[model samples]
Structures are given as C-alpha cells and as structure tokens.
Target: MGRRLRRAGRRAPAVAANADGRLEVFALAPGGSALHHRWQEAPGGAWAAAWQPFGTAAGGAPRVVRDGSGRLTVAAPAPSGVAVFHRRQTVPSGGWGEWQHLFGWSDAAPALAPSADGRLEAFALSPGGARLVHRWYADPAGTWAAAREFGEPGAPLAATPTAAADATGRIHVFAVTADGRIRTRVQERPSGGSGPWNAFGERLVAPLPAGTPAC
Candidate 1:
C-alpha cells in the first residue's frame, strides 16, 4: 500500500512531475485559506518532510501545468470567484516566483493545458456555469490573449473542465454537462482554433457525486 503523507487538505491534491522528474503535489488548506506544496526529494524518492505554505488560494483545488519551456505554473481561483492567481517556477525545476493575478471571473476551478507550440492555455467556467471561457499565451513564454468563450454559447457545464494534450499535440477539453453527460472539444489544429464540442461517452447512470472531478 502507498504510505500517507503528513498534512491534510481541503480538496484533492494536484500533482505534476518536474523537469528533473521529481513529483510535486499541491493542495488547498482547510477552509481554502491557502495552498500548500510538497515534493519528492529526488525522482521517485521520498517526499519532503513538511508541506510548505505556498500562497493564497481562496477555494478549490489548484491546477498545475508545465509550459513548453519546462517551467511549472500553478493557478487557483480567488475567494470571490472574480479572479484567478498563478505562480511560475523561475526556471525549469527551480524555485517559484510570487503569486500574480491570472485573470478570471470563474465560478469553478480552472484547468490548464500546454499547447503543441509550447504556449499555455487556461480554461474556466463562466460566473454562472453557463459558458466555458479560455485564454492562451500569444506565444511560448509570451503575453496572454484576451479571454473568449469556448464551445457554443448556449451550452452549459455542470462542473469544472479538464484539459490535456494528445500525442499528436492537439489539446482536448472535457467536461460534464448539467444532464450528466460527458462532452469534449478538441483543437482543430496544433495551438490553433478549437473544434465544436461533442458528446463523449454514453450518459452516466447517475450524475457524478458533487465535487467529483470530471475528465
């Protein structure tokens, strides 16, 4: 069986592998007051002795993604749900910079995915969960583009969305709809326009339990 770590968290932890291959974990503190982090001392090795208080994260679990340059960036929503904050490693597998506003108006946790060309893209549900919106870097390690709605304007999501890049480098986003159906949208081209959202797997027999993270 896997051994338990020392600290507790308000939400399930988010994890990612560093450029050096060490495993890092980020978690939200009880009451969603802050974010804490721990990491493997070495690749596939024992975890750090204590959780380090990283930064503020009003609520919801944090999300981490490695940009094309190999730097890790983490983002979380603010308490009011009107903004998101993020921090990035100064260098690949190195120390992180101060937390900075990332832009938002998110009603739920945010999701991130790295583009084929090395740019980073962020996704979140609009204030009422009535639309999915996203923004992406203009270029690898560059400024961000304006946020825009994703998918058809009338469609709504029941929970936070999740995103990942496929082997071919196209990014795909997945979410659960109000009716308990899974839907997905894919990049029509690497680091380019997105295709329309489409139904994914067969409808779930029962809606996922509240707080369950949908793919």
Candidate 2:
C-alpha cells in the first residue's frame, strides 16, 4: 500500500495520474535540450512541460502521483536534478493549472502515489546514495514533512524506482536490479519506514527488436 512513481522525461516519456483522476505526461526534447512534460484533466486535455535545459544528461527517470482531491504529483528528471511537481488548478474544459515545483533535488527519480482520499505521498533516493526518502504535502504549497526511509542502499541502484499505493494508502516500491532480478521494498505511513530491497519477483524481459527510444 505504498505510493507509486513512474519514469518520465526526455529519455523515457512517462505518464502518471492522481486519485482526483488527472493524467500527466513527461518527455524530453531533441538532443537533450530540455525535459518536456504535460498533463490533462481528462483523456484529451492539453499537456504542458517545463522544458528547461540544465542537470544530469542521463536521467533518473520521471513519474507522477495523484491525491484524492484531484491534485497530481510529478517526480521528473531535470537538468539541475530530480524534483517533484504538483497539479493545483482545474481547467474548465481541458486545461490544468500551472505545475508547481514543490520538492527540490532528489538523488534519484521519484516514486509518487496518491492516497484513497486524494492525499499524496512522494518518495525518492536521498541526496546521497544512502537512504530512500518520503515526503507528503496537503497541496501544492502545503506544509512539507520529512518522511522515513523505506530501504537502505546496499548496491548502486540502477534504473528509475517505481512505486505504487493501495486503497489504504500503503506503499510498495520495486527496483529493476542490475542482474535483472526484481528487488522490492515497502513502507507504511506515520511510522513504518522502507524495508530492504529483497528479490521478490521477475519482470518479462525480451530481446529488443531494434526500436529507438520514444520522444
């Protein structure tokens, strides 16, 4: 029942949704120029991106999460580093209020997820390659709290961390291991922190058929 986050950005475009039922898209421009992103109220809502150039050329991956009230939280890669973005306004027909930069730099791609009631909780690797960090905000600019870590760093983590939350707002995180094993971690709210990255499952990996990364 932990939160969920996905990888989005120029290198790997990602799409996320909140409990409020909105979707956000993340992508990159040509030649690593900028990180492009967008969000929609419904299926056909217009999408927008920060698209500013700056930070790690290689991305940590991007993801999005939504709260119960209809707010969306996005964890995306930027030139300066990995950060969090939140959706605050409602578009009359097919628009969204501007995305607000909520949380600052993260050591890795963020894991975002929404609670059953629309509250949002976000997670990411710490500034150093040590602890997994979690944070929650009532809205775009609400009080921010320091969340507990769910896992400890054992080996260098590769790939973007993916997260998911259940009906009760419990969170689960999975890491695609260097050796291709699926390592998983979990946590609970208010107290229970991250667990160890234990081998739990396997992903369906297939040989690439020679396709370029999506833009």
Candidate 3:
C-alpha cells in the first residue's frame, strides 16, 4: 500500500535514524543552494518542523549518517570540494549544534557510513573522477586522517561509489566499473586497512543509466 504522493524538487533525499529512533530527512532545495532537513519526534509520530535551510551554496544531493551517539553528520558536493557538515541535538526535540564543515573533494557526490566500531568514514571520487579517495573521523568529530586512495592503477569506476558496514565489522565499498561491471573493496575492522580491489569478474549489475551522477 502507498500513501498519496506529494511533490518536491528533483534532488533525491537522504535519511537517517537516531539511536532514540527519530527519523530525519534531508534534501537539496530546488535551487541547489542549501539543504532542507525535517525530522520526526517519536515513533509513528507526526512529522514536525518545517524544512529548515542550512549550508548555503551546497552542490549535489546530501549524504547523511548517524554516529554511535546518534549525532548527525552530512556531506554534500560543494564549490571547493565536498564539504562534511555536522549537526548534534538531544532527544525529544533538542536544539542543533552549529554546522561544521569537515573536508573532502570530488566532482561527484560523496558517500558516508559509520564503521562497526562507530568511527565515521567518507568515500568520494577524486576531482577528476579517475580515483577513489577516502578519509575517516576516528572520533567522529576530532581530527581526520589523511586521505587515502584505493583501487588499481588503471581500471576506473564509472559511477558514484557507495559503502556499507556489516555487523561483523567489515566495511565494503562498491562501484560500477567502466567496463559495466561492479567492483568491490573491503576494509576490515580494528586495523582499518583495505584488502585488494576485486572486480566481481561477472557482470553482476548493468551500468548506471545515463545522466546518473558520477560517484
């Protein structure tokens, strides 16, 4: 069953759930200048708050994730590069902290996920889209590690990259290759180092549709 739909702008929305179970949604405004966020106060509760605007002059769609403590961090394409922004609030509807820009650079959108250990990691395509680069917030708000590039010298990715962390503490990143197949790389927990880049060797999925944004 589906509820009757309401219309919005073209940019896709990103969502996250807090530890307390509040639902938060973020989307790019029609003009692409800022992000609009809305959230619920409780389970099955009526969505409260209007779409509040922040981060003027943003680019692409925003990516959001929650830390172990349920704080929110967002990354979106920006003029200089991708900018990571953070917003922290208490439960039962609380005031949000000031937005802070972290760091990143990519011609395409960035991806973010919390590792099994609860550290925040961000993945983005290089400025030229020739390489995949990443950085992590060891403390999720403290100093960030130096950027690292992964994958072999030649085979380039053809679309925006994505990442996920499983219960076993393994973080997997996936992308579509120029040859129209999918490739994956893993970074095991604790040590936080990646294994070899493995092309699935089979065409697991078709290439991204045309006009899809580059990863």
Model 2, C-alpha of 79: deviation from truth (Å): 0.9
> Largest lDDT belongs to which candidate?
1
Mind giving the per-residue lDDT tens digits that candidate 1 earns over 1-215?
01232234336788999999998998777667777889999998999988888886465677888899898999887877777788889999999998877766763457888999989998877665676778888877647888887855666667777899999999999887777778899999888899988889786634443333454
Task: Judge candidate 3 against the unseen true structure and give its global Cα lDDT, from 0 to 1.
Answer: 0.66
Per-residue alpha-carbon lDDT of model 2 for 62-164, expressed as tens digits? 4544455554444544445555454443532234565556556553456666544445666665444345566776554444566555554564344445677
The regions of model 3 sitting more than 4 angstroms off are: 1-9, 79-95, 209-215
> Which has the better TM-score: candidate 2, or candidate 3?
3
- TM-score per model over all chains: 0.88, 0.58, 0.82
Cα lDDT for residue 93, candidate 1: 95
Candidate with the larger lDDT of 1 and 2: 1
Give the lDDT of residue 9 in candidate 3: 51
* Candidate 2 ranges beyond 4 A from true positions: 1-10, 16-24, 35-61, 82-108, 126-129, 138-142, 153-155, 167-169, 177-180, 188-198, 201-215
All candidates in order of lDDT, best leading: 1, 3, 2
